[model samples]
Target: MTSLRFTSRTTSDGVVERDFTVGEVPGVLWSPAAGPDHAPVVLMGHGGGLHKKTPAQRARAVDTVTRWGFHVVAIDAPGHGERPLSAEDEQVRDEFKQAMKTGDIERFRKVSVGYALSLAERAVPEWQRTLDAVQELPEIGTEAPIGYGGGISLGTAIGIPLVAADSRISAAIFGGGFFAYEEELAAARHITVPVLFLLPWDDQYVDRQDGLELFDAFASKEKTLHANPGDHRTIRWHGVDDGFLARHLG
Candidate 1:
């Protein structure tokens, strides 16, 4: 386990938001100022182009701590957030934007998946290292149950592999991501834990069939797919039941 250093601030709502470094990775941990001695922890991942402190991430963190009574943690994916982008990363980003602007679905799909897969490869290992570091924190508790939750392209790309590899993660809320790469689909087969998969019926980036195929690939005996009518970004904020997480993970 890598060593961790933490810096925290108290929100007006009384949640403690701690920023920490686990080796070279930057992450945030959120918890209620007062909670159970050993609250379960949820490891969250942000969408592509977004960082750990994005509005959605912050809202989910606060909701989980105050409403769900769980601690929340999130890390910046490689070349994202505080991490500087490499030349190759910049090129990929430019190409993806161009593809989107030109309405080149094929080009967009190819480049987007490639970019997501590359990030996933690096992000999963960092998440594991982060788990190692966070589990050692006295406030987090070593034996508490851990759940993985995140969405969109990068979050799903990285999270599928992380959940497949880590037995400590007992449940997951997978949203806004699809089976963009073979490795991500393959990883799903190993994820037998309970999963709540959210699908955006009108998602622009992901084909509905592809999302269904990915959901079916999960080895989990208990998995639920909640598909709502909306595009990718809209689905992120709507048409999802919050209580599902508490029910499955609690």
Candidate 2:
């Protein structure tokens, strides 16, 4: 696999930031330049505890999505970057981290699910911000089939925290986002949209079976799940079997 080199060229070169409003919650947008008018809009987030746009995902935004004629936007989730994690949230996270470090997988799962759900409930501002992030795209307003999505681990974990009722994202692709089955089914009961999911075997981040179980809930006929070899990060960059990606994304 080739390691990506960041130059003052295409990848980060196309990057630009702007602010937009979603209801009352304001959000910042990072739009990377794609060739021209692409149909479905793809939104992205960096891994948890990271900035909005990590180099790897950002590189994929340009190399994979932008090159494929899909407009890409990556944003820092609430409490990430300039956003501040609440004191309660920080304490919870610290305690949760201790549990995980102790190799208590069951406890980790339980705490994570509860934490994520609580976070989502408390994320009224973040939801509005997500809506605003899309509304304030570089291309601005354009009625189109929106593809809301993200990557492995927390980046693309589940669409629950990222989506609001007003969101019009039609086609979403979750690449290696290890979705928890019960959590996804719970959050996606009302979500009726075409979603595309790619899960990798041996991915330690998110459970594979769980991801598939979640994907199965999509009422839309267009939703699908693909399981293959390669770790979480590899399937993302190194020769992403984009053969299926191009068709679904378009």
Candidate 3:
């Protein structure tokens, strides 16, 4: 099992942010400046083309730490953020850009799906290893409950598989923005933990029915679907049961 190596630390607004690495994977942990040991931990995933600490993600992480008093952790996905992008990753990205420039929707979908799956394949184990390191910390020992605090799109794509494979995760929050691939649906089928699925009623690239289908695929007997009218970027989440994770984790 790999251990976390603290690389930097900063504090603001009663939240302490620590940058760390689990072997080669760079990640950030946000926690309340003052909190009990073994508090619940939420593993947050960023959207496609975004890094671990984007403004939106940081705000959400801070809220999770301050509002729920739970620790929040996020990591750079493969070839994203501070991680070095491989030549193959660069080529796939170039193909993706060309497809978008040429108005090739099918090519764009194909390229995006392939790239997302590849990233997810590398990320799931990275997350598990990260969990292993996080549990070793005295403040968030092995007994701390875990939840997937989703970022939609690429986040949901990777999180579906992570929650399915890791029994340590007690609950999850997922949203729709990216295409729902078959493998994602398959992964959702294995998840029996409580779930909250957020759907953008209208998305520019992904079909709304696909999101519905992905929600339907979840085997969780306790699952809720919340929909709002807008695309992923413009959607405002309202009336969500923010206590869902706290209830399950505690």
Candidate 4:
């Protein structure tokens, strides 16, 4: 069991942000400056090329802490952000660049799906270990309810497996930005928790039907599909239940 070591802390706008490491995985946790113990914890995942604390992600984390009094934590995925890239990471990055440069859509999908699969394999256990360490904190004991605060692209790719493998997460939010393979669908089948699946109705690189199909794969009896027009980058989520997590996890 890896223990989280807090390395730094900062506070602003009624939110407290702390940087910590569990073994080699670097993570950031945001909480209300003065909050009750055993608050619901939300695990937020960053997109493919982004680190855990991107401006947008940080904003969301702060909002979650402020509005819902939920602690939000995000970690640098394997070979991403503060973590050094391994040989496989470098190779896949090169492949992605070459495929995009040469306008090879098939090659792009192939390499990206393979890389997403590899990253998810490494990330699931990292998240479980993170939960283990996080639960040890006095403020957030083992009784804290947990949820995955999802994102599009690589975030969803890795999150699906984590939620499937970890029973602690009682509800999850996922989005579509990457190509879905059979394994992802299989994992989805195991997730009995309530899910909110977001889909960009007009993703240029990924077919819209793929998102629909992936949404269908979820075994959650209570799942909502929220589709917004535009690609993943330009999406403006509206009309969806902002209270979804609060309703389920509260």
Total clashing residue pairs per candidate? 0, 1, 0, 0
* Highest TM-score scorer: 4
Query: How close to the true structure is residue 32 of candidate 3, measured as C-alpha lDDT?
Result: 93
Stronger candidate by TM-score (2 vs 3): 3
TM-score of 4: 0.98
Residue pairs that clash (backbone atoms under 3 angstroms), model 2: 178-206
Total residue pair clashes for candidate 4: 0
Candidate 2 TM-score versus the reference: 0.73
Summarize candidate 1's per-residue lDDT along 1-250 as a digit string, tens digits. 6967886666658688889999889999898888776688899988888999998789888988899788899999999999999898999999999998999988988898888888988888899889888888887767778988887667888899899988989999886555456888899999999888888888867778888888888999999898888777776455567876677667
Per-candidate TM equals: 0.93, 0.73, 0.97, 0.98
Q: Write the per-residue lDDT of candidate 4 for residues 1-250, one digit (tens) a residue.
A: 8899999999999999999999999999999999789999999999999999999999999989999999999999999899999998999999999999998999999999999999999999999999999999999998889999889989999999999999999999999977988999999989999999999999989988788888999999999999989998898988978788888888
Q: Which stretches in model 1 have alpha-carbon errors above 4 Å?
A: 177-179, 236-239
Query: Candidate 3 or 4, higher lDDT?
Result: 3
Worst 10 residues of 4 by lDDT: 240-249
Candidate 2, residue 64: lDDT = 50
Q: Please report, in order, the local distance difference test score of every candidate based on alpha carbons.
A: 0.84, 0.57, 0.94, 0.93
